[model samples]
Structure formats: structure tokens, C-alpha cells
Target: MAEAAELSDQPLFSCRNCQNPLALRSNLLSKNFWGKTGPAYLFSHAMNIIVGQKEDRQLITGLYTIADIYCCNCGEVLGWKYLRSYDVRHKNREGKFIIERAKISKEY
Candidate 1:
């Protein structure tokens, strides 16, 4: 396992356009889709069907399969992918999230 100190020391992902450090936004995690019941009901209902109804339903929030890092200078996408975290719940927690690996595209 990696150490917390090692993770924190890593640099934050930045945007390619502006060269600014990308902000971690939850909405950028995945593609938004409308559900049958309604736009708001789609995600929650989909989760239920996939994971099944259970006590930990509240805890088991849908997955964030992507991360958006932008540039500080020009506002460009630096990278994108499913972030690897030590704790799923406390992903943004200090000493938890780390850029262990990343894929930088030409756009970035």
C-alpha cells in the first residue's frame, strides 16, 4: 500500500488550455442521463436496480468514474479518468485522494 505522505505530495491535475489547476467537481465524474421516471429520479433509481435494495443503500452512492483537471493558465482539460482513491466515501478527504496514475490526452 502507498503511504499518505506520498499521496499528498503529488501535484494536482491542471487544465491544458489555461494551465490552471483543475477543480475537483462531482458533476464531471460521469455522463448525465435522464431516467424514465424523471430527470431527478434516474440516478437514484438506476443505482437501486444495479446494486439491489439494501441497508447500505445510502452509503453506496453511485460511482464517480471520471475526474476533470483543467489548466490554470488557459482553462483546458489536463486529464480525465476514474480516480483511484483509498476511501470511496471520503474521496476528497485530506491524505486520501492521490494522483497515483493519470492519462493525459493531446487535448490536455
Candidate 2:
């Protein structure tokens, strides 16, 4: 009963393609982010995601070693995870995730 209550209180973000739960609204850190397409969100945690190979990419912020994240259920390319950041200024985002706004839907 308590678990159900907790789940109900926490809104979820799911994949737009297959409705796979990706992250919780509580884990959302920032919405002022950019992805390959457009707006993205920074999340402190994410679930049901497959982290792809680590590679160095020069983003607008700086060079970062990131891995492409995919939906585990439908294998849709959702976003990427920051594996390593070359810049100290971006160190806080090292273990975080950037999920594209267009790829996910918010569930109440």
C-alpha cells in the first residue's frame, strides 16, 4: 500500500515510442539543455536505459566522454549519459543523463 502510494506520487517520464519508463520527475535537475534535435532535460537518475560505447564528443559546453543511451525495451535512441567530462566546470554532469524532451513523454 505504501509502495503504491509512493509510486503514485512520483510522476514518470516514458519513451514516446514504446512507453518505457525512463526517469522520475523528482530526478529532473534542469530543463535548460540541448540535444541532437532540440530541447533536452538533465536528470540525476534514469532507468531502463542501455548505455552505449563511450566516445569523446565536442559539445557546445565542452568535450565530454559520453555514451549514447537507448531504451532497453524498444531499443530507441533516447539520449546520452555523461561518462566523463574533460572540463572541470562540467564535472557535476559527469554521472548524469541528458534525455531529449522530444523523445519522452511525461506521465501524471
Candidate 3:
């Protein structure tokens, strides 16, 4: 699927190694962003296939802690899931699934 130049409509993603369905095209977190850790190129409001654990280091956003996410099936490092604190803005964006495009199987 990655060989194609354009992405498919309503694309459903999978883990590149195990083919486990992850997120959809609509789940993209919008604009790609770079952080101190690296880059979170995509984000989804929800992703059932990903599992994460809290990390000690937090990001630039106060009350916005990050967790490392991995594939439930293959145990491959996916991206991250943000666990927001009491801050209103941070709470609003909680449960977002930030991902790395290259790590996920592309649909084209």
C-alpha cells in the first residue's frame, strides 16, 4: 500500500510488521508536529490497537504528560498517547493517539 503515491480514501491502518489494524485516516492529529522527544506526525482521537505506559518525562505542555505507545500484537514501538492533567485545554485533548507515519502500515 505504501508504494502508491496517494493514500486511499477512508484508509484503515495496520501495524507494519503484524498487520494489526491500528487507526484510520481520519484519526490523523492534523498538522505534523515536532517535540523534544522526536516527532509525532499523526494523531487519532482514539486507537484501540495501541497500548501505552506512563513515562517520567513530560513534554513542553504543562499538565500534559506523555506515554510511550506500542502495538498490542507485535510489541513494536508506535508513538504515544497523551495523558493530560487538570488543565482545561490539556484535558480536552486527552486520549489522543499520536503516531509515527513510517511505523504504521500505510494504505495507498
TM-score winner among the candidates?
A: 2
TM-scores for the candidates = 0.21, 0.93, 0.66
TM-score of 1: 0.21
Best by lDDT: 2
For model 1, give the RMSD to the true fold: 14.9
What would the TM-score be for candidate 2 when compared with the true structure?
0.93
Off by over 4 Å in 3: 1-9, 35-38, 46-50, 61-63, 85-90
What are the per-residue Cα lDDT tens digits for candidate 2 across 10-81? 899999999888999999999999999999999999999999999999999999999999999999998899
Backbone clash count, each prediction separately: 17, 0, 1
- lDDT sort, best first: 2, 3, 1
How far off is model 2, as Cα RMSD?
A: 1.8
lDDT of each: 0.27, 0.94, 0.66
Candidate 3 — which pairs collide?
A: 29-43
Candidate 3 lDDT by residue in tens digits, 1-108:
672324345686778788767776676766466544566555655454556667545556665667878788888887777766556766756777776766667664
The sequence of per-residue lDDT tens digits that candidate 1 reaches over residues 63-105 is: 4434433333453333222233345664652121112113111
